[model samples]
Target: MDDLARLVATEDVRRVMARYVYSADHHRWDDLAALFLPDAPFIASTVDGSVQARMTGRDDIAGQLKARNHPDSVLVHHLFSSEIDFESEDSATGVWAMEDIVTRPAGEPAGMHGYGHYRVRFTRLDGRWLIAELRITRLRLDWTY
Candidate 1:
């Protein structure tokens, strides 16, 4: 890919991520699921490789997250400093710096405040980029529940 093409692809990838953040924060589970490939995997872990949770496929990812996320919960994610490189015209790898906060509903334990890097593989499918695999490795993770 030329520089111009790569630039456009990077922006497209970022747009997908922004959509993910919006859907998640808004608790739009199905919309969040649609951002991934049907068989995509979502993995979360600590920096030392102790896996916290892993969900495969878009439906499983959406369902599990929806079940775990209480209706009154508050979640926010901030992503920036993305580094995206195209491996081919239809495939790319990226890393995004992220900080997030999750607050549980009243009467339950509060949730987590975290800083992490999202390492992802993206593939262009049906004219848009979708996450093929996503891994979150926390640099600092603090949780109460």
Candidate 2:
């Protein structure tokens, strides 16, 4: 791998990661679907024994995100970091630890706080990189009853 190739691959990985966080936080379901391949697989789990379940396909991803962003949940902040791993020039995998804090209307209980980790897989197709799989494992969760 040459220096230029490495730089380009790194940049592509970074851009895809940024898009994943931004689209999820902003509730841009359509954009979020675009972050992955047409048949990407996703599974999100929480420590509270609640599982968001595994979903496949772009349409399914969009549907899941739409259902996740509720009216009471005013905001979603997904902080990703500590990325580690790249298998090849066209394929790689990494980890991203995230913190999501949600806010709600006054009087009502505020939204939950979640800490989780994502195992991300990337694949390049036609010069563009996209997520192939995203498996989320929750470490901690705090929310009102």
Using lDDT as the measure, the top candidate is 1
lDDT of each: 0.91, 0.80
Q: What lDDT score is found at residue 13 in candidate 2?
A: 81
Per-prediction TM-score: 0.94, 0.84
Cα lDDT for residue 100, candidate 2: 76
Best by TM-score: 1
Cα-based lDDT at residue 21, candidate 2:
80
Candidate 2 lDDT over residue span 1-145, tens digit each: 6778877887788788888888877778889888899999988888965775878989999997677667556666575675746678888787878887776666655467888888889999999989999888889878843
Q: How close is candidate 2 to the true structure, as a TM-score?
A: 0.84
Segments of candidate 1 deviating more than 4 angstroms: none
Cα lDDT of model 1 by residue, 1-145, tens digit: 8888888898999999999999989999889988999999999997677998899998899998998899899999999899998889999999999988999977776699989999999999978999999999999988856
